[model samples]
Target: MPVDPDKARALAFPPVTVTVERGRLRMFAQVIGETDPVYVDPAAARAAGHPDLPVPPTFFFSLEMESPDPWSYLADLGVDLRRVLHGEQEFSYHAMVYAGDTVELRPRIIDVYTRKGGALEFLVKRTDIRRDDRLVAEATAVIVVRDPEVAS
Candidate 1:
């Protein structure tokens, strides 16, 4: 089945809130091989002028995934999980986020398009991260779905 671009654009997803924890930040930094003390140590981050342990690059994506049933939007769109590919990911930071900060993520579909006569569908989702209703960062993700009808 082909994706309905209009429907996709009209989709409204509920917002999710996540609290940044120092231990989790430290653990994530260790897992990602981040040697920056500011990302793992509150004192180091404070020494570096941050109020708390700073979040690592790309870590916001994981925070956004804190949503329960993160993949439910795709499922609701009737997308085949097996044929979906992560095409691209981008982030624009407006302000620094740190441990102990509670951030809210509001996601929406920015665009939806098809190519190769509908064999490839691209869904662009943009998430706005806010702390106390103040914009902190914007994350964009492009999802590519291969149409089995045309590809096969």
Candidate 2:
């Protein structure tokens, strides 16, 4: 394995607080072709019984990307970016979120495993997002690392 499972499991990213912004959300809606007006217009969102433009799905991913020191998690695991592949991502929503709300994300290592005689390493992280102590979403990301020595 490129990374020791024990060592990787000890890695944890600092909690990050982000305030959802309308402009960014609108741009995201535009880019992803989310024709839903609720994603782009606050008025439409209010009409739909939302405080503000409901955060379009998957917006948390982008917010987390902007997290302080986005590479800190990898650094703690001593993983090389060149050998890492973003294998998968998933999100579980617990409650609705709106633009302008401040959310905090706490990310931790959830699983670490190896395959193919340790030539392939799989690392999974689960990030919990909360709004004022209420769980809003939990995002999972899977990273696959290829051992450089195995390639030779």
Model 2, span 1-152: residue lDDT tens: 36777777777577899999999999999998889888999998999899998886688888788786887777667778888999999999999888899999988888998888878889998899999999999999999988877753
Q: Best candidate, lDDT-wise?
A: 1
lDDT, candidate 1, 1-152, per-residue tens? 78888889888899999999889989998988899888888888899999999877699899888999888888889998898999999999999998899999999999999989889999999999999999999999999999989864
Compute the lDDT of residue 88 as modeled in candidate 2. 98
Most TM-score-accurate candidate? 1
Task: Give the Cα-based TM-score of candidate 2 against the true structure.
Answer: 0.92
Candidate 1, residue 90: the lDDT equals 99
Clashing pairs in 2: none
TM-score of each: 0.94, 0.92
